[model samples]
Target: MTTHPLLQALLPLVDDLSRELAEDERYRRLLGTLRALIPCDATALLRLDGEQLIPLAVDGLSPDTLGRRFAIAEHPRFAALLAQRTPTRFAADSELPDPYDGLVEEHVGHLEVHDCLGCPLFIDDRPWGLLTLDSLVPGSFAQNDLDNLEAFARLAAAAVKANQRLLGLARQAEAEQQLAARFREVAGQAGRAELIGQSAAHKRLLAEIDTVAGSDLTVLIEGETGVGKELVAQAIHARSPRARKLLVSINCAALPDQLVESELFGHVRGAFTGASGERSGKFELADGGTLLLDEVGELPLAVQAKLLRVLQSGQLQRLGSDREHRVDVRILAATNRDLAEEVRAGRFRADLYHRLSVYPLVVPPLRERGRDVLLLAGHFLEQSRARLHLRGLRLGGEAQAALLAHDWPGNVRELEHLLGRAALKALARQAERPRILSLEACDLDLAGTAAAAASSVVVAAEPPSAPLNGDLRQALDAYQRQLIQAALTRNADNWAATARELGVDRANLHRLAVRLGLK
Candidate 1:
């Protein structure tokens, strides 16, 4: 292993630092110190959520992945680690598929990192996450380096706990601020006309919302993530007579289980440790407006019952109050999951389901939303350029085509992030001339000839948004993954040879294969 000065200084501090990982305030500095010690170009902390590894803390990496997920089945190497439940090493010539291929070229541009070691952080024999280190050079780690890696990984386990708590607090603060800002934006605009969409489906959705928006009907807006369900709810509230009142929306899935109820219903003084004064529940604050319960499917069963009571009756009792408070709030619920299945599974109340779905409106995914992707992408690009002052920048025809071709599993949210990165790169390009956005700039590796071909041309005019047809996306992805895996298995996981024949990134091929469950 190549040893550096930073490691020499940090080696003595491992045990001490590992102990301090439990300290919340020192979390970042702890990760920062380890990042410096490893001298990696980028270091990331992944926390296990069910069977997925979610990137939580990142240093010297793209912020686009502050909360990105990598499913356990997505990568063979990662799967192998999970299966064996042990630390493993993978070099450029390892037997497993490389997980970082497409992601590296399109985002980090790190071509090196030949020697990689990963260790699972276990709390009570359950995997928490893995600590990853990447250097700018290949073949950098040796067997002797395993000790330090394990030490750091253990420390990362504790750091993950501290980090999650810190992040939870940070999220609460940010939610309050953003919610305040949003409420301010739409205040006193109730009973106003809604800016309904021109499309048939959208118009119908708006009509349904309008009928309920005025009646304090608990609405359920169902759709895939990033499909503008929140926007639909906002339109409902804005057009309703409740425009003069507060519209409170919160993502039920985003909040930790322990804090969901507390966050929704305000606490009384001395209710808990942090309750220094009385606070108001969202229902009370949105008394005359609407409370959008985003991702309502994710609500814990314990909390779901309470939410149901609030939806049924127009009254709610705060955390510490025995006195029931009546509120004139309208409820608008949204979810990306199949609540029908949830209801069947007894995870959600059937009564609540029936009540909220009184005005169920589904928003189409970007790929199925005919021309909306481009409209939204263009809108996002404009927003990016306007916010960043990125001048003389345009998406190339190839990039547009690639954007159109993408399944957009992340939906509109993903497009916004891609445009933001592309805009940043366009700024770098403006030193010479008008910067044309391409798949590369968008941070899409544009793997496969289809992707590259789609991205290479110049677009003459603005194109239609939401061009794709349907859920055949999952089928297509499955087919492609099947082909790639067949070839890799035939070649015994020889990615370089496979890439040579298929003519794509050996890395990306692996990553895609992993995503497809082919790996």
Candidate 2:
């Protein structure tokens, strides 16, 4: 006896759903089969995380849609879907706005989605996530279509259950090896007061920190420069049982290579030329507490070997001393460089990298933190007002837009400095003591800097052909002249500001302007 065609097709899909394949590949194949089974313009598999639906696999949505997190409370269609267990279909003319409006990959400049079908997947009688099918044509799905989708949803649920079990087992093993009861105690503590932000990225970071704070595993905090790597270290120390003990910090990059060893581990008298008296290093001072190695990627090879020995046995000897002393300390390292790549490049040791990165925590960049930018800006504004003894300070609408639009390469530190500079600029221009000091877009100076950087790239990429046909020196001079002129215009003809924006000294800028016939 032969089975039905739909059942035959599903047999192979279930067989291929094994632990050997990657989870993302499994989701892609599952969504692909659903698309073939039920003809639709788009299909998406979303995982429910708290109140947000994170796109796991999207077949026909824009690339950016996968990066977006849809909040259930904000979208009526998602709320309606979650309200019931049965497959829910929305009418083409339904007043409720679609969560994925203007997000279809094929339909550019169009926001309306004609037909939508969504089904919630359940595991062990609990809601797990949703499987959605969308069509550009109105009234595309019929009653029978809903039945077919509901069948597919059952298979998807089973696959998700299997995947979750596998993941849970792996997590169990890792937790057993890396964590202890201390982690649970620290997990419940309110996070450090200095690290502020309520975005999803921020919350996720805090959660990761809390989970690992109780453990003695070495943690490597990685992120871009000025992304608050130090703040993360402080949070870990504050949450740990070692909070009462000292938290000693050392910046590897700040000290010379010859002195890095003495700074990290104590040195005895007569160890080096400058060793006047025996001194206790950061590691010794931080005994029974935590030690933070900031910019640890800059450690020399010789020091890295000694550091690895101490990490392994918790025993270290002072320079020029044979006696070894045992210390109890938790190691926390932070860096902006990719240590794995550094290890591969021969600049860092692989063994030390493995020793330090038992648990790695990443701090999210400022641009990815969403509306947290506004919150941080407001915080910085208040700080500036307090420091300057101003009556009041606030960002104008245009200034807020500029802050949101700019891609902050320097992260939180950059934002704070920019806000401080803008506040001072605004106060300088104010003739009277106003009730509220307002910072305008011009005061921020971000628009000019952003435009200048963008235009410089464009100008560099394609120079004028007419001028290039002349003397090579003249064409070079002309290009230089154009760049300076643009910077001058952006800075409103202020020579010092123009020089600063162009990254040249005021005297050098004046000399260049004269040589280029712009003086």
Candidate 3:
């Protein structure tokens, strides 16, 4: 029991604890001490990506759950932990909601945890992950105990960093082996696009995209707007061998008419009136990276010619430069138009189309993705509900059927807009729940929707054009007046019924109607 040389040598080890807490070796040794200090049945370290929280390490958990996500929405305790990103302790039957209820029942039944202490992990003062401890006994922690646990979190954060720096040098060999092990463990877990669908069309599209993602080939993503073509392009770039490099985007539709050429290819001094200095173009800036030409259908003809030159020769000459320069840049172009038709019509270059289409991926519209639509809808609803601080919100059975029944013409974009609108209305308590929350929840103005419904042909209702000669406010008011009048007439001027149907408050609808002089 007397002090010994080992105990004398342990002072630095104690001093070194903070930065070493998360390192594997240190974590194991400190695990029993942490549990005694905090007194818990289970404790876990969670890693986060954006709002996602996945389990990383833990005690008292079975081997199967080392790497699974516990979504914040589904776990109430965890949700509050995320919102505060600070340490908290819970007692059995506490007033606060227990968010992790279902996960516990499903994952570890009968091993009931009645108390918890949670602390967020942060790096650079920005949140990085979470540290959590749970217990099965009620009233296990007093106020001072909770305070002490938070202190432990602070110390743990320090140890995590220190050990990470030290063991990082020694981890190279171990990391490689672990990585190889995980690659096999997660073989098929890399689900397609994180956007699920089993349809033959969807499968084929996935296969083609995967085949081209490993290559340096140019890719053209073709699809309707809202079909997530850009995300697919991102997937290709991210999964490609070029993932470590940059991925830049340019919306051809958004380019300035006078500056498109100089923007795509560099500009030399005095290239034009405003060209005051030499500059590198997008292609050069994207050297060793990927350039995404979004809305390629909108590119002007002159610009298209220059673009063709770059694709054909891998060379670009600045606007006023006599010499040409070359850079290594991969092109990923996306369009929602029928480029083959454009090529036949001479609007697009056939050879350019061929080059860009070496790997063509058509993202099927959401309506065609079968069960994926419902999954997406549920996901969107949860996100919208949380963002609006509305809870227990969901699509009623009728609403769900209507959403699935309709052919989402605007695709995912329309669905997101509809869900967002319904969540807003839910915040106001206007509708019981969103039934797609009522097609009225969407961009389907009563008149336009009815008109479209009546027609066997689906006509793209040109959004009311921007007025050339009036204030934008006036244009908006005019559009509102038109929509309100149509809704009133369609519903025979019953304010409550109209308001209910349109997902707006009766008073607000009346006010809008009066403002628009629809009386």
Candidate 4:
């Protein structure tokens, strides 16, 4: 005894409900099986995203149809199909404009659909999306075909349900990992990055991170210098399903123009003068994980194009090699520069900028975090105390007041260094280490150090008196040189220390120094 043909066509979909599959693959298989059973010129599976219907898979239609979005209000045919739960077949002379007009493959010059059959898929008794089949021949779908489609629609809904359940399980696992990591951090594990704030701005940033971490969308983190943009990236990676994999970072601004491409996409042996051995770049190293492109705005135009290619195609080639290597990498880019302004100025690629900023996140500056400064200060103080091997370390009354009053131009990094310095100064004033060392306002020296550091101009340009002397660009360069020179002197010519003092990434500082001829 043989089972029915329709049941045979649907058996694979039932088998799929027990197995894991990519969402697109599942949808594609569903459409393929449906077309095999019911002949049609075109078919598509669309998922409802708000008021828009996004095509997840399409068959016998123009390839571009997968990219086209149909609004429910704009397409009356789609609206009619979604109005009911069961199958609906439109008449040959239906007055409504078909969304697929001029979209059927190989059919030239505005081919109008004559027959259209669609079933609104329901999950938990609510409208989820629609499955549609189109034919150029009129009266192509009969009552039996409609019944067959209605039966298939139930299996389609089950496939969607299974996909959703699998996704939920993955997210649940990632969430569990995030919670465990947080618990470990609170239990005094070292080297773990923490957000460390309770202010509204900080809370909002955390919420945004939580919302975007489950998916593989590229996130562009934008903020001022030392605003903990990298910390935000870490939080995102830690909460994602890729948390178990490595989280690699490359400072784009640190490398020279010639080396940036090699550092990102890698090179084969003897690819260049210095290429002695085959080396995998950050993209390859970060396979099945995350890559944080620090100072991504500083990437050169040529490198930007290649990077965009990798992102768009998920395929890359090493330098001087014809072979393409496929990688699965989730990108998290952080930049202190205004990338949109850079794009307008022709300094950054607009296409790359748009791709990277699919989910833009802005980290709030420390000044906007209100009393979270004190909390962060306390966190740093404990770390300082641990390093100094002191019994206890706490801020004095005046120190707390001074911290609240002053504007933190350098952001969190500045506060951290200030606390460390203040702790040392307070310790030196005593003959022996006290049981609890309290840092006073005088120990901070906020006013004096900030003013002196702000006034450095060792290379001798036009003084502050001549504000508009020479070109505006030259004046800006002169000021930047002065600032870098001063910070270098204060940091004992340590580029890394100077970067922290100036609240910039060390690689970014190096790029600025080179551009300003101060390197």
Candidate 5:
């Protein structure tokens, strides 16, 4: 007994339904099977997420397609497809514009009126998402094809459901759900502040965050500047038991040395020359909550002693007052500097470093996270689109290539700022507000930026000209100081870039800089 062609295609997915395949692998195999049966030029399975449709899997499309978020309101064709219950095939000459213009693989220019078919998937009798197929040839998908796609759509929904169940079985699912819900709430009210990535480095970071968030252990988040360490802290607090309580943060580097003690442990009237009245410090304000000591490496040795005492006893006195107040606060410290090296250099106290680094979390730099850069770029592009009130914004093929090729020294924050600037540049190039503005390589100018950065490194790497007049070690130290100082000036005091230019590890550079009094 021979089975139907659609049924043959779906049997493998049925097997996949019970297997322990990764979520991405399951979705990819589902799309692969759909393309094999349908013989379409492009196919995608997009999951409906509130007002937007996010691509879960794509076949015969650009890799960056998975990063894009298609808003139903912006794409009329998608809007119309979801409005119906059965599969939809647009007319060859349909006046509605296609959303996948210039997005079909190996096809240059915009996609014109052609064969477009979509089937809306439903789970538990509610709208879930859309299964779409596209081809350059008109009249390619006949009525029979639509019916076959409808069958495939049902199996696709099953695959999605299986993935959901697998996620639910995992112990981390509840925490992830809460995090997602909090993300949605905060995104609706203000700018979005959720981690967006699918790379292995990002997954490792997420696993670590999940592991440490459930406990009250002190966490030292160490990462380069602009790597979103504060976001990591927020994620920990959002997933922790003290989520409902306040998560206060103070920048140690922003305060004067004399005020550091008062800021963290509170101050009373007449404590200092500028002390006007009694005030609650960050620890008091964040009592029974979480407090983030940003730039913790910048704390003076004197203040570090007091902070260590408070961390040890949970008791602190207002400056110039003998009275003590007990509070329960969880400490989360962040720093771009290597505190261990600082301790070795006699700058940071070894005991205080030990107290703060109960569990250290290192955020991988942006250069190490591969395709995650595109996902993050998409996130930022969406934000720019909404802020600038543009109809739509997307990256051209060359622009994506540029982004992928560059080494992101500044990490996620750099990518966000770059996309924001590129969108505006692309918008200005258009004669009028385009329906879908595409950013080209020229708009990004990443190549030019890289060239400039390279030139600066060359200038900063030159050997010092001034002759030395002391012992061998003294001469070497003077030369090192000159090289580091020049690099720092050229790189605008970015220690990471300076380290890179000098061909030394960032931690080693910091230790050397401190020893030479160049910090």
Candidate 6:
């Protein structure tokens, strides 16, 4: 007996659903098949994550829709869908707000979906997520359509379960073989780069990290040198679904221009003069994981072009190789340089900059993070105390004032190093063994700095503002003189230390000091 064409079409879909290997491919094909079978305007599959529904695969929705996380309490439609067992269809004129309003890609300008159908999926008799179909036309779904959708929902659940089981086994095997000592070392380093601040700035940064971590978006982290951009990258990786996999980091600036391409894309044997063996690149190593490109603004133009192609297509060919390999890597690019300005100056590729900055996260400087300075100082003090074998360590009131007043040009790293130096100095000066090691303002060596003295200056004389005449050059000269003098005082006339603190060469700083009549 011959089977019907509808059954014939569906048999292949079911077979494909059972045999597909990649989870993303399976989801894409599953959604495609459902849309073909049900004739819906839009369809989405969401997975339950804690109290939120995370979009796994979406068809006919806005690109940004997949990046969104719908909280159960925030969306009444999703809440209603989860509350019921059977397929729930909302009327075209239902009063309840649609979670995906204005989110459909094709329809713009506050478009409200007229009809909606949702069915919750289950695995092993427990709730997993939901499959949703939406239409712009009124009453588009009939009873038969609902029934068909319900049946398809069952098949989708089976496909999801099978795919998850396969993933579990594959991950188990990969974990067993790939969790080497290098992974442990990287994990430990990531653990140490914690975001430790309670200020509003810090809270906002943390919130941004949490929101973007779950999605496979390319993130660009911009900040000044030593502002803890790597820590932000680490936090994103730790919070992502790929947290179990390796997070490979490469410093673009540290590598020579000649070797940057080879380091990033790897090379086969005989690719270069010293190409002794075939090797996997960072992109390959970071497959199913994340790759952090530190100081990405430093990449050569040729390498940047290649990087852009790989990012766009997820395809790369090793050096001197004809065959192309596919990799799945979520990229996180970081730099202290202003890439936008670099693009304008022709120093960086504009296309590459746009590609890398799909999601930009800026780490606030230490000076802007107000009261967080003390909290971070306390943290660093404890670390120093333990590392330096001190009995007890505490910042004195004057020391706290000095810390709050300092500009912290080098940010958290400078703060950490300063605390370490202060602790050592305090320990050395203590002739008798004191029960509590106290770090005073003098011990911090910031007495003559502009920041330290600003707190004590009379308001009328200094005013903490530019001069009324607005003589920009004169004002800058005065400010530079103050900074140089403060650095010299803090360093006890040690020009090298002063130059280091000011981030200038020793001879240059000395020349500037002499020019300003500070000799």
Query: How accurate locally is residue 373 in candidate 5, as Cα lDDT from 0 to 100?
Result: 84
Better of 4 and 5 by TM-score: 5
Q: lDDT per model, in order?
A: 0.61, 0.77, 0.63, 0.80, 0.82, 0.77
lDDT of 4 by residue, 240-309 (tens): 7887677789999899999999999899999999899999999998999899999998899999999999
Worst 10 residues of 5 by lDDT: 184-193
Question: Which RMSD values do the candidates have, in order?
Answer: 23.0, 13.5, 16.2, 24.1, 6.6, 20.0
Where model 1 places Cα greater than 4 Å from the true spot, the runs are 1-204, 210-214, 429-519
Can you list the residue pairs that collide in candidate 5? none
TM-score of each: 0.49, 0.53, 0.54, 0.56, 0.80, 0.54
Return the top candidate by lDDT: 5
Clashes of each: 13, 1, 12, 0, 0, 0
**Per-residue lDDT value at 499 in model 6:** 61
Best by TM-score: 5
Write model 3 residue lDDT over 1-519, tens digit each, in one string.
676543343434466564434454576554555666656566777766434675545675432234244466555777777677567767787666542321231233343456777888775676667887776667776786667656666666666656656767335434433443343243322322344444566777778876898789998898876778877876676666665566677888787878888888879989999888999988988888789999887788777888888898889898999898997899999987778866876778887889888878778887777655655665565566455544234444445566667666567777777667666654555545432222223422323442442231112223444543465445555665555555566779765556566665343355456656876
Which candidate do you rate higher for TM-score, 1 or 5? Answer: 5
lDDT of 1: 0.61
Candidate 3 Cα misplacement greater than 4 A, ranges: 1-76, 79-201, 430-519
Candidate 4, which segments miss by more than 4 Å at Cα? 1-190, 456-460, 464-519
How far off is residue 172 in model 3, in Å?
18
Candidate 2 per-residue C-alpha lDDT over 306-423 given as tens digits, one digit per residue, 9 for 90 to 100:
9999999999998878989899999999988778867876879999999999998989989899867876776676557557755345666677788887777568988888888888
